[model samples]
Target: MKVSCSVVVFALVFHFFLVTGSRSPPPSDSVIIIGAGMSGIMAAKTLEEAGYKDYIILEADSRIGGRVHKGQVDGNTVEMGANWLFSGGPKSSPAHEIAKKIKLRTLYSDYGNLSSNIYKQGGGLYEKHVVESAFKVADARQEFGTNLSKILSSKKGGDDDISILGSQRLFKQVPKGPLDLAVDYFYNDFEEAEPTRISSLKNTFPRQLMEDFGEDSYFVADPRGFETVVHYIANQFLSHNNNKITDPRLQLKKTVRKINQSKNKVIITTEDGSVYHANYVIVTVSVGVLQSDLIGFVPRLPHLENELPGENMIFVTVTDEESRRIEQQSEKKTKAEIMQQPFGRIYFAGEHTNSTYLGYVDGAYFSGTFRSPSDSLYPLLGRAT
Candidate 1:
């Protein structure tokens, strides 16, 4: 599903003025970007590069990186969210390019090695032939699920709400015994984060990581943490001191409480009782947050709507009817929401908004920057293809 990043603006437009928590008047801008994650920061950088600086980024967390955060584990810096950068996609991942430009350390991880290390419940390693046979059966079942999904998705109107389990049963590849079940869990449950019984075959089947980005997945080994790339991107547009963004354009720890949209503009109220006015608003919060009641909308958002393999740190993904439901309208929603359209003056973006590559950092990058004209970002942001 393709969507364009359009105008976003808020609450009943009027000349009435009221006392706010801040002694100073609330600031207004051409755009108010919610969330300082990959998508939000990219949007800001795009605007900044275009010489359009009338924008402010409000991030709820004290830090700038959202899910792409790093934590100290025993003295070693470790990624808490996204770690692997799939550089070999049909279109090279922009994140991969940025990592190279910034010289972020990375190590190639062979996920196939994971199978060789698998052990039995008692701790003895499984025989090579046994492991191979188990995976072969699992692979066949996945192929069955993929083919079945294509058949269902090709239906006249759209897809039928069917779980992958339904197709698996017909394929007669039911897992038997502990080893078989373990392989099943590895291929199905671990990959999709949902049991086949509940996973929508049409939406979740057909793992595409290898198909799109090749077999190699590079693990970020940067001492600064995987999120250092985001800091590097931010440094491009915002002034920074000692790796910390010191620019006034980026505001941290500002939790937006409500967004009121009017015909003329948008009024955003934060938890601190501070109000902000903007002609456009780009929301890049996670799907989990949007599905939650964390931020209220004067006019509730409109309705709308996968998993893949390869050392994937992201357990959830959202697309198509599934995308619209996860994004605009909530339907058998998961932790991830895929695509979203412009709601009034608000434009939605994030990894979830990328249908083809949802759940990846590169997805969020492209969603914020390189969409084609048919499905591009704001005119001010421009398009690469």
Candidate 2:
């Protein structure tokens, strides 16, 4: 499918507004960004930079940094969500720019170490030959699949209802044996969800981008925590505006029960009988939360059509002393990385999303955001089921 240029424009405009703080609250329009995760905060910052001051962030949880949760364990800090800085190239990766702009320290990840312990189920532990053979095979398969996608796109109308796997089989030759398994592993590493559910064409885009513009790098701040970064960003925003960052714009502990949206206004009702209204509302809650139908919408969302169901991204942190010791020793080798699986609007973004640096402080910094088409304030008017 063709990418939407309007979404790209919106993202760019939003980013600009965040960085420049040029937006002012509209006289009749107000915005409410749900969740305080990296994406939500980024969205809020974008609005703030754009001079839009009449916006509030509503967080379901008591704390900010939705998926980028962090805490201390045995004197070492652990991240519950997003970590790693895929790359720190002076240009391209926005995360890198944000890190530098916010004065956050980062470190380069060591993927070439070739010292990973192979965990086998029955064959026991063996010194696998660097698995370079598998990687090579996977690479070739990926290239072939990419070329095949192009060919399919070029072909005249054949069948619009063909499955993605069917298209791959029609256009590209599949790699066999270890190569196929390796390709599967590589794809898994990138997607973080499931391989069978992803489209070969769609998967290749981010993989290609990461190969070119991304770096497998992560950061370890002096204090070794992800909250520092969040605190830094919040502080900077507040400092620039001379406003108190602790202002309760977010209605924490007040779960949103229903949303009522119209062409002119959007109203949100909490389970506690409280109501909030705004012109624009950015729902930053997790796909898991959305799928649970915890929050009801009035008119319902149509962009959700053909969207994949929620593939919950779990974050498990092993913060024992022994684990921490092992972590430090493998610090250079262990870095936050992302699994490149696609599951539609339910984008995965967390530190554990990667394997090498599962629970590192940097992992919490690596999670990303996603937006849906019908995500505007026009879907919350009807009654709940």
Candidate 3:
């Protein structure tokens, strides 16, 4: 609880940011946020609601919702990784403003808890009206590719950019047996653990195609879990009680490897060498942990340019094994040759850099709440408190 000495926050608030897109505000407030999950705890809870609580988050797991985690099964406390929150009520933003300020408990999930007892692949019992007619031909080929992507974006052709294996090769056809391969294993192996030929049918698919939580799908029956909306948003100022947190500005394992930055500040270090200085450094990890380098910057940092189509993609896109050793050392693309610009004291949050709720938990809470704090530092905090 001590970071207001003018400023020092290098918050690489995990899920990260623009890469080279300048935003400016460093030179002080000492921020070092690098992923206490959910976009570095909503970018240090929107820099402690703009007054700037002199930040530090740095988590590398030993727990703290990076993919919005949580385990335990038959004994309950579910959600292993970023569970549903799409189409929630009262316009579901900020996870329905913290699930209606902590009332929490939700229900309505489809698919993953798929009932009607259908089983096969070796067992038997598979009918339920032929898996509801192959989920009505996979919801009429995702509503005829969302009406042919709004008639090819009314002519210019963009949004809903195809892919569902390019609409099964533009409707030539594929899934036709074992109940259309269990409705393609419930929209590609249980709602995208991948293989709909690089996902994205009608945008992050059905529910997370966002329109402010429309087609309804809410899980989190909150048996005091679903992180109780990250412990009621980290007990507001983070000390914590019944849930036991202890806050040293939420450190956790602090694994970060090497950042560096300079021209004024930035440093970072970790992996036990321990050195943490900051002017501003928000990274928010995952584009599969920045293509699995596991953090090491020193002047070599220009990530984020994944777009994704498929030549057998893994990590949900390229097909993970470190993207099959980055497609056997290159079929090209590592952001073409790196550096696409985006760095002004570094910044980046998540939901794959969010466009319009890009991968949802409401697009990683709108990429960790986007942030504010700089009204030219409020005239030096009105000339020091």
| The best candidate in terms of lDDT | 1
lDDT of 1 by residue, 21-92 (tens): 122333233788899998889878865654456789999999987988899989999888888877565756
Give one digit per residue, the lDDT tens place, for model 3 in 1-385: 0000101112223222222112245323667878876667776776665556577888877877777767888898877766666663445567656876787788776654353667887887676777776777777876676676556545532322556778766876677677677677666546556566655564444443445556466677676766667667777767877777788888888889888887777899888788988878778776666655678777765322232332313212455586776655533233221221346567766665553455555555556665312122223333332
Model 1: lDDT of residue 222 = 85
Error of 1 at 49 (Å): 3.5
Give residue 369's lDDT in candidate 1 (0 to 100).
Answer: 60
lDDT of each: 0.67, 0.48, 0.60
RMSD of 1: 9.6
Clash number by candidate, in order: 21, 43, 49
Better candidate by TM-score, 1 or 2 = 1
lDDT for position 197 in model 1: 74
Q: Which consecutive 10 residues in model 2 have the weakest lDDT in total?
A: 1-10
Q: State how far residue 139 of model 2 sits from its true place (Å).
A: 1.6
